[model samples]
Target: DIKILQLSLRSADLCIESGTLDLSLKILERAAVRVERLEIFSGDDDVPIGRTLSAKYYMLRTLLAWHQTRPDLAEHMLCMIPEEAINNDLQLASELADLCYNVGQQAFSKGQFDLAAKWLEKAAKHNSRSLNAGDENSPNVKLRLIILHMTVRAYLEQNSGESRTKSLQTLEILISYYPNELAVLILWLEVMMKQGNPDHRIFYNRLETLVHVIELTDTNIKIILSYIQKLQEWSIEMCVRTLEQLLLRMPVLSDNEQWIDRLFVISIRLSTSSGVADSLSLLDAVATHLYDYLMKPLSQTTANASLIVRLGINP
Candidate 1:
C-alpha cells in the first residue's frame, strides 16, 4: 500500500504539472483510499509518520479539489489537516502559503473581498505558524510582506476594521525593514488613522518620519488630511505644528491646489475652535505661510509647490 501510495503521489504531481487535472484527481483518489484504509491520524508537531503524512496527503487532495473547481471541498479538505503538520514542514507550509495567497488574490481581483480576506488570513496563518522567529533566516520576508499587504487590501476593500489591526501589527515589523519605502510608509499612516482612538501621539510621531516623504500623491494627501482631522479633534496645536513641519519638508513650489486649500481650511477651523483661544497666533502663522506659498504664482510652478500651497489655502 505504501509503495502504491508513493507511486500515486508521484504520478499525481506529474499530472498536475502537466495540466492533467482529471488524471491527477484519479491518482489522488486512489491514494486517499489506500491512506484512509491505514487509518492514520495527524499528531503533535514532534510526532512524525502517520499524522504528518496525513497532512501532506490532505494538502494534495485539497489541491486536486481546487483544480476540480470545488472550492468548498478544497476548503473542507484543508480544514481537516492539522496546522502543526504543515507548520513543521517549512517547504510544505510555504507551498500552501503561496497557493492560498494566490487564491485569495484571485478572489480579490474578482471583487469577492470577504472570501479573499478569509483565504489570505489562512495563508498568513500557514506562513506564520511555520516561521521560526528565533532563526534569522526562517520566514521569507518578501512572502511575509505579500501576505500582509494583500490581507490589508482585502480588509480595506470590505471597509472592515481588521485592516487597521492586521496592517498595524504587520507594519511595525515591516517598517523597520522597509522604512524608506514610500508605499509602505503611506500605508502605515493610513492604517494608523483607521485605528480606533489609538494614542493621538502615534500619528504625531509618525509624522516625524512620514512628513519628509517627498511625493504628495493623492493617496498620501488623503492620509495627511485624515491625520490632520484627527489632530484637530485631539489637539489643534499639534495639528498646526505638524502642518508646519510638513510644509517645511515639502518640495518648494508645489502646485497641487486642492490640498493646499484644504489644509488652510483645517487650520482655520482649528483657530476658531474654542480650545486654542490664547494661541490664535499659531493659526496666524499657518495662515500666513499658506498665503505666501499656496496662493502665489511662485507656489504653482511645480507639483510639489502646488501640493504644498494647496494645503495652505482655504476655499
Candidate 2:
C-alpha cells in the first residue's frame, strides 16, 4: 500500500510539473488516502513501521511537498533513500529507474558526464535488480543485465581503467557463453578495438566462427547476414576494413558477392528512402575492388562479355 502511494506521489509530481493540475490533484488526493491508511496501520504504538514502509511514505510525502522554497531539501531527501529499497517494490523500481535513465541520458547528451554517470548507474542497478528478482537465467533478463553493465561501464570508462577492463572481461565471458549474441559481439569488438590490444586476433577468430555458424545453419542466414550488414553500415572504417580482410581470406567469390550485393542494396535503400547515407564510399571501394578483380579482365575478352552480361552488369 505504501509503495502504491509512492507511485501515486511520483505521478502527481510529474503531472503538476507538466501543468496537469486536475490529474495531479486527483493523484495527490488518492495518495493522501493511502497515507492515512499507512498511519492507521502503523498504530499509536511506540514501535515504528518497517524500514521499507517508512521509506516509501517518507519519499512520497517529501516529493509531494516539494516547492520552490524548499526544493533543495526535497531533492536531498529524495536522494537520501537507499536505492536498494526500490528493489523490494518492482513497479516503483521500474518507474524510478526509467525516470533516472531518461534524466541521465539527457545529461549525457548535454556533456554532463559526472551527473549523467550518477543517474544512469542508479537506473541500471534498479533495472538489474528487478530483472534478477525473477528468473536469473531468462534470456531477456540476461540481456537487460548486459545492457546495464554496458551502460555503467561506459560511464566508468572516463574515470577508471580498471572499471573498463572489468566490464570488457564480463562481456568476453558473456560472448563465450552465447556466441550467437550479435549485439554483445558488436560491442565486444568495439571494446577490443578500443583497447588496442595485439590479442585482437582472438576476436577476429570468434567472428569467423560466427560467420561459419551462419553458413552451416542456413535457417537464420538471412538474420545473421542482416546483422553483419548493420555492422558494416555503422561505420565506413569498419565496413572497409572488415570487407577487405574477408575478401583477402575467403576464396569463394560467389558467396562474397552475394553478401556484398545484399549490403549494397540495403545501403542504397536507406539513402533513397531515409536520406541517411553512410559508408557509401566504402561500399563503392569494396565493389570496385571486387569488380576489378573478378569481372574487368574477363569482360575485356569477347567470350566473357556474354558471361559478364548474364551476371547483370554491363561488360
Candidate 3:
C-alpha cells in the first residue's frame, strides 16, 4: 500500500511537470485517500512514513501554487509542511531557505513588515545553519548577515514593544559579526534610544570612537547629525558636548552646508529651551562660527577691491 501511494504521488509529480495540473490534482487526491487507507490496513501507524508523504504532498502543492501564480497559496502550502519533515529532506530545506528569503523581501516591499520579519527570521535560521559561522568571508555567510540585517529593519518598522525588542536582539548579533560597521552600529544606537536604555552613554561613546577613527566622511556626518538631534531630547548636556566636538573639527569636514544648517537650528532651539547662560554661550559660539564661514569669502572680495582701489587708475 505504501509503495502504491508513492507511485501514485510520483505520477502526480509527472503530471504536474507536464503542466497537467488537473490530472496531478486528481492523482494527489487519490494518493491522500490511499495514505489514509494504508494507515488503517497496515495497523502499524507509521508516523515517519506519514510525515514524509505529507511533506512531499505539500511541497508539490506548493509548486503547483507557484505555477498558478498564487504566491499567497504557495507560501501557505509551504507553511503547512512540518519543520521536522523539511529538515529531514536536504533539498526541501534548501528550497525553503531560498523561498523564505524571497517571500520576506516581497512582504517588505509590500509594507507588510511584520510578515517580512517572520519570513526573514526563518531565512536567517536556515542560512546560518547551512553556512559555517566562523567563515565570515564566505559569500553565503555574508548573505546570511544581510538577511539578518533585513530582519532587523523589518522588526524596527513594526515598532511594537515586542518587535523593537526583537530588532535590538538581531542588531546585537549583527554587531558581534561586524563590530566596526557604521550602519549596524548606528541602527543599534537608534533602537537603544527608542528602548530608553540607560546604558546608552556607553554605546554613544563607542559610536563616537568609531566615527572619529573613520574620519568624518559624509556618511559619518549624516549619522552623527541625525543622532545628535535625537540625543538632544535625551540629554541636552551630552548633545551640546557632541556639538562642541563636531564644531571643533569643522575645518576638516568636506561639506558643511547641511551641518551648519542643522547645527544652527539645534543650537537656537536648545538655547531657547534651557534659557541658561551656558546654553546661550553655546549659541553665541555657533553664531560666531557661522558668521566666520559666511564672511570669509566676502573678506577675500573686499581685499581684492582694496587692491584695485590702491592701483588708482581713476578710469
What alpha-carbon RMSD in Å does predicted model 2 have with respect to the real structure?
Answer: 11.6
Better of 1 and 2 by TM-score: 1
Query: What are the per-model numbers of colliding residue pairs?
Result: 19, 0, 0
Error of 2 at 187 (Å): 2.4
* TM of each candidate vs. truth: 0.62, 0.48, 0.54
- lDDT, candidate 1, 213-301, per-residue tens: 64667766666767677766687778877876666444353555555556655555565554555336676665566556545543343
lDDT of each: 0.68, 0.52, 0.68
Write model 2 residue lDDT over 1-315, tens digit each, in one string.
755765776787687678676677677667667666675665555113333554554454344444322444545756755455575666556655665565566556666666566666666666655564446575446545454544645554566776665566657555755566656555555565556443544655555555553332334445444444445434434434454445433334244444444444443333334333444444455545656555533223322322332343422
Superposed model 3: Cα runs more than 4 Å off? 1-72, 79-95, 196-198, 209-215, 232-315
Find the 10 residues in a row with the least total lDDT in model 3. 306-315
Weakest ten-residue segment in model 2 by summed lDDT: 297-306
Deviation from native of the Cα of residue 296 in model 1, angstroms: 20
In angstroms, how far off is 242's CA in candidate 3? 4.9
